[model samples]
Target: MAESTDPNPAAPVPGLPERILLGAAYYTEYQPYERLEADLDLMAAGGFGVIRVGESVWSTWEPRDGVFDLDWLQPVLDGAHARGIAVVVGTPTYAVPPWLRKTYPETTAHSATGVEIPYGMRQDVDYSHPTFRYLAERVVRKIVGRYADHPAVIGWQVDNEPGHKIFYNPQVFAGFVEHLKDTYGTVDELNRRWGLTYWSHRIADWSELWTPDGNSTPSYDLAWRRYQATLGHDLIRWQTDLVRSLVPADQFVTTCIALGQQGQDITVIGEPLDVAGANLYYATQDGLELPGAQGLEGGLASFFVPWSGPAYLSLQADTARGTRQAPFLVTETNATSIGGTADNFPAYDGQWRQTAWHMVARGARLLNYWHWHTLHYGAETYWGGILGHSLEPGRTYAELSRVANELTAATDALAGLEPVSDVGVLVGAESRWAMECMGPLAGPAHSWMGDPGSYDRILAAFYRGLFDAGLAADIVSPGQLADVGPGLPDDAAAAALVARWRVLVVPGLYIADDATLDLLRRYAEAGGHLVLTPRTGYADADAVVRSTVAPGVLRGAAGVHYLEYTNLVHPVPVTGAGWTGAGTAWADGLLVDDAEVLAGYDHPHLGQFAAVTTRVAGAGRVTTVGTVPDRELAGHLARYLARTSLPVDPWRDARPETVTVTAAVNAAGERLRFVHNWSWEPATYRLPAAVRDVLDDVALAAGELLALGPWDVRVLRETP
Candidate 1:
């Protein structure tokens, strides 16, 4: 529970080795042929340090009720240990066995009241259901109890990527009512806080509450989402606690989060975990190019890809680091092409090494691919792995093998590296859930329909801006803002928080409590630059629109007020002092009070209102962005903020169009720089300081030109 931006960095986890652990999820059970020995030899030869097994096949683990087949994985574990490759045993709870589903039909999750989701897919059961919970616990104990003492087992993956479903079962809804009753103490309090009197939605009794299936009320939807997230949190916490009791303290317990999954708050779910873990998958090939693709066109699907590819990938990495504000494990990433048959865009040549180094530079302690080999027949048959359908090593295997060897060579300098960032981006699950319920922005093709990804788009835009401007950032949640972890005095804690992060960017924070908003205002007043984007502080914690002026409590600090806003059907030209870019999707009609207008609209009708403004508040500054700025505009804003608020970056001289650089401090307090040429064309950058290449053990003087080939990356440590 340490403060995310603590000046004193967290020490490395006790049990982990002092190196970047690299491997893949090995599913020996799924292989068509018995080649366990061959695979283990290949992994050892490839410099793999670990392998994850037994997370997916519940049917294989427990083929029938009250029957367990636990010995099948002994050979895989024994072979892995013999080769010095560590093993992370996973509890097969995410996917239910056919026997359990067939015998307990009522445990099947309901998408709507009385409408059961069929059992063809995984995570189709209501985990909160007592019957399902009992069976899941039984199986978890059976699996962990069997392998906890194995010499090869170094950790436990509690469950594979949870939070896929929001259960609407009778028991789940009933528990929600009980949860509401406990939280509110009475029905009247719920009615008052939720403003249930509007539209005759007030209920005299708890029984009168409507199910979430068709609840159009924003408050109800937010509460439902929050409660559902708790169910997932409780399940993970429960599983982790159960696993801890069975396994030794050295065997870490963690659940890999599929970030942005439905009905789960990653920050909350990660609290009980020993170390944060996440599955990061990104578009490869041309999608990995820098200064490349155009910005998202406001489509929900397109939100996954941003104007800057590195920015999008870094965003996910930053998010994973944010969960614990420390080094995290990459539980799963693309070994080859990810997704369906039509999406066979694997990494191009050295793109794999570039990405692996990128993850390491962003504070990843371990990296594991989704799988070892591609399955011959399954729903994800086309989801390629290191080895192809032919089960032969190819380009991906060679590329990853080289990466693993490099990681092994650079282990001493790269291990337990804490990424350095001067900027912090605030992200909250409530705001995201509230935005999803409200759908304030429109889709690219249809302005009439609401875009469910409005919050993601806004958050990504600001983060992309920082990345495009060569500024490293930490993605933080509102909860981490005030948590000045154990043993810090109040005065020192406040100073540590402000001194650690010079600037904070909060975008689309539509749902914020008074404390969170007040903390943000105080941060600005305490000599930190506070950047507020559109839809921030527009509503209360309950998703109710504030009666005060937009931005509510922070309006005084921001020195800006807006009583009206509009959703633009097309992009509108925006002009500032020395920059020109377009605002897309939504715009706020800002009526500035005392703030200096930084930008304005070019359209005739919207020309009277300011597009961006800033003001000095106490010892710091507050900047307000009234619309979603395009990549160019956002980058300009980020550069301005960085120049005024952050120390001059050492790698600022590098060309950002092709070459990008990020820095992290290792446990030994040595700064490590990861430089990548994210382009098809070869590039070179001058060393800002004398450095030694950790991987190659080569030294270079300050101002020496470093040549990099296509899709290349270099890890350097600063030298005197």
Candidate 2:
């Protein structure tokens, strides 16, 4: 064997450097070090320690596939190391080289409808195609082998972000069908769980199977997407395994995905890594908004966003830029939109220190600047980057060095310290896929307009509503919590908190197995609060042989008959032809036997349906909201949960909006509060009892809130 090694389980692993190591991507076709070094000096001066190298190496490595060169990589690696910055080597799974694309035409992907786009696009590869996996694996293995032992290599990012495809890929359907066949051992069995008899979707032969897409769109049933999601997750799983096969167990390995747009479940992406980090770019002007516009829930969940997994990364963002962006100024996101937007965007030049300090205060350990190098040709044409379009350093270099060195100083402490938490949100990946495949207006195969239009719309509204409510929820993997206790960041604390947060809200997740649901049911029966929204606990984790109406095995817990879910009452009536209907707020109707109706929906066409129902089951109560609720409905859910749990209010002392805050308890039982000033004017915030600033070591007055400057960061702690 290469070298038998044992990563210390007791000692904290050094994944992300302390103080949020700051650095930039440095990929300029031919830029002088003086200019590059000038920026490097600025980065070092500004307090950046980690430099993301080689995201754009494909353009140089093989102008065409089959040709390889080690000439260019050495100098850059040497340069970054010489500057004392550790490098996060990114896998080039995204953006296949033209040569590779040409040489391996088979690697190209096709949409579910069988529309094939040859060349000239990112994420165009069909995930289901064996050739695509083969080529990607080949390229990744080659890269890992060459750089696995490199001194500068500190972490591994499998792809810039995989799963950018699932929506439009033909591979999703194909792979899903194959997975169901393998997992079930037969096709007839899969049909029974999906209730395929309704849409004439029953199939006797596995070869005749279709996916969850247009031509191959498998009846928009939950089982189809459940299987497809399994496929998507399997893609990440298989790829993650490939990463570990190449790298040692100690090295942190992960994939970076866009917020809200991740095609696959993010819960799985972080499974392979020691730490799970994501790109967090919260818009400074509007709360949790991005520097530039993208989608609705901009960056609210950007930092560690509530997950039941390993430690996460807050690796991307720019606090201060040369250009005035957003609440800062021009709303300039990054210098250029090279991360993947059209060019002609605003750019910035500034020191990277303040943000570094802010991240540390906010609880980010591993810090990475958006773009290290300006992409030479295609990748750089737009998007943002640390390197100027000219491909040289400007004002952010020296600052990078300074911050990285600072992180290096506190590396051991930061790496060793575990992040604290109290609340645990259950995230079931199979459930999400089931919802996706079930179409917009999903029901138990019995509802008006049970097409894709209704299902997708309802599902989106449900998730977005949860997000808009500022619930601070996250998708968690049960595998991570298997070790379930206290003083530990993983499963231990989650299990220990059974009494603390006995109540959990699962919105639209279906395939929770008995073991997983038992955790919730037992917690609730033990006087815990449980909120089971529409379509929960129906199928097993495998999602293959579901007998219950929910995703998997937890179906029998609610003790309700598997009657036809036919009621589709809209709380608000619909008129227009647009996708949004029923006020896009309250949509589904609930059902109950001896349960109580907390809420309901009454519309013109559909009869009155129970919008909410509550019943006492063991030591707990389950309130099922059988509809996709919009942002406005969150208050109702919150109000109901509040009444049921009556637990200590986490936001009891939180004010409205002048200052937004999120609080968590560390593994040491220390409280780390992420307090963000949401206003331009300085304001005071009332601190919790006895909490003080961790760094300042100042004692906070119990009922007295402290004053903060505009956009200031404060870490509160108990008085020393």
Candidate 3:
């Protein structure tokens, strides 16, 4: 067997490869025959440089409890190494072996209803259980000891996407109580913060506290969510530390964090890993083109695309990149329909390439398909891979090879390129948690609150607005903005991260701590622009309503105050400064203090209140939006803000349907442009100068009209 030479146990945490990494998840244990050598031939032909293995087969690794059987994986790793392919070994802890499951039944987690989840599928195990941890350590030590010196191994993916489920086990519940005790110290403090006096629910002892089941207090639910998020983070850190103790520093560790997985705090989960990764699957076309997508004529919906796949994908990819503040790896994506279903559409001719290149443009250094071949038998048997179940080279395989070759050609040009933008979208885990506790989105009782999807809809609307304005934006998390305190953080790096952005967008962040607001106030005072929407700063970090007026702690900087708001039963007409639109969902009845009214409601009773207002704070400015703006208003504000504060404007025009452009510079200061037509119809754009496409080497001149077919994307390199 080949052995690792000198990777240097102490290196400054190696980053992604210099060239783009083309890879896929390989399963040698799942093969029907002995085809390790033959599979390597296909991998080489497709230009794959890496294969992820050993993550899915825990039962195969240990046939019986404590009986290690790694004989099957050795040949696969060695064969891939012989063919010049690297390997990323998975911890295999995601799926528990039947023997271990039966021996220590407590390892399995229970749902909110207190029923223990059966062990048929994966991610049913309670990560907090001591039995699971003890056995996991044994298996991990054995695997790492054997493969730590393997030549082909480059990294380890820790327990495939922790936080897919929440553990309602007794251990977790006791841990929750301990966490609350550490935070509050006494029962009176907990009672006060959670407003237990209401409905005579006051508690005298800590034992009275229970899980947030059924209709528990909102504050209790918020704390439970936060605690669960921490649980996920701790599991990742524990596994990462275990791996590092045995392997060299160069052998990186990561887990594929899934977005919209409510139980996990992504920022904390990604903090301990060497690099960040995400599994991004786009929404199918059928889901987007449904009725009401196009909206009524002159309505708010008309302002956005019929389908918002481009913005959603961009948002997910940007979230991943911002997690580690560096280029990331797409650890899992699909070559075809991600699931086996008649409704699951196969990837269009050029769609997969477009999606892959989109990630590259957003600063992903590596891309890997979920699997090499479709499974012969399983729940995901129809999730079509690069190769079909027949294991024959087909159209999907040909497409993979083509994309692989193109990425190879453009590797030098795309490597180390950083996306540049003046806008930052503020997001927080606690904010999401608080919103979840706020209650159902739709009901006659809470008619002022919009539907269930209102939160995401508002965020996506503004994101799409940025696209329409031809400006790119970054999704900024609270962790990335923490001030320099007791830490060894590079002060220069911390300052530069926030300094790059000229504008900060806040979307209904109903829950925020004082420190978070303080950070925002300082960012605004330091000459940064602030954009605020309704329902922001209504509650503290504990999910308790602020005692002060709405937008508490931020009111001074925001320059607006509101005591009453209403959810729109129908769209309300709004107009200001030559722009016209309608407000949806909820609208704040605002009385501007030191701010100037930019927009006002045109309704009969609400005519006295402002719909939008702006305040000047030192060297900065804050604009408070009282409701969700129509598409026209969104585009108007985007262009107005771009021309006001930003020094470098990337787009020449704001024709929503024509094109959207993003610009970035590599470490070498070479500027690259990503131009996209995020629509289903044909579009065109005029080139600014003579430029060459990075992928196809096609060149065009300034003032030349370039045509783009439906869903087309072009990466152009500027000529010196």
RMSD of each: 2.3, 8.9, 5.8
Give lDDT tens digits, candidate 3, residues 403-433. 7788888878876677776588887777777
Local accuracy by lDDT, each model? 0.85, 0.49, 0.74
Report the lDDT tens digits of candidate 1 across residue range 1-720: 111234656565635677788999999998998999999999999998899999989899899998889999999999999999999888888888788878999889899999999878888888888888899888889998888899898899888778888889999999999999998999999999999999999999999999988787888999999999999998899999999998888888888899988878977789888888898888788788888666853121123343337777899999998888777899999898777776677788998999999998888888999889998997989888888888888898888999999888887897557887868899999999988877788875554327878899898888888888888888889888776434565445555567767888998999999878887888788787899999998888889889998878888999989989999888898987876788888899999989999899999978888898999998889999998988888888988887778877668646658888888887687888889999999988988899999988899999899999999998899987
| Model 2 C-alpha lDDT per residue in residues 114-142, reported as the tens digit of each score | 66666777876665567767766776777
Best by lDDT: 1
What does the lDDT read for residue 712 in candidate 2?
56
lDDT of 1: 0.85
Give the count of colliding residue pairs in each prediction: 0, 89, 1
Q: Which stretches of candidate 3 lie over 4 Å from their true place?
A: 1-15, 32-34, 284-307, 340-343, 439-454, 483-498, 648-658, 679-682
Per-candidate TM-scores read 0.97, 0.73, 0.90
Among all windows of 10 consecutive residues in model 2, the one with the lowest summed lDDT is 321-330
Error of 2 at 143 (Å): 4.1
lDDT accuracy of residue 210 in candidate 2: 56
Give the winner by TM-score.
Answer: 1
Q: What is the lDDT of residue 636 in candidate 1?
A: 84
Sorted by lDDT, highest first, which candidate order results?
1, 3, 2
Q: Clashing pairs in model 1?
A: none
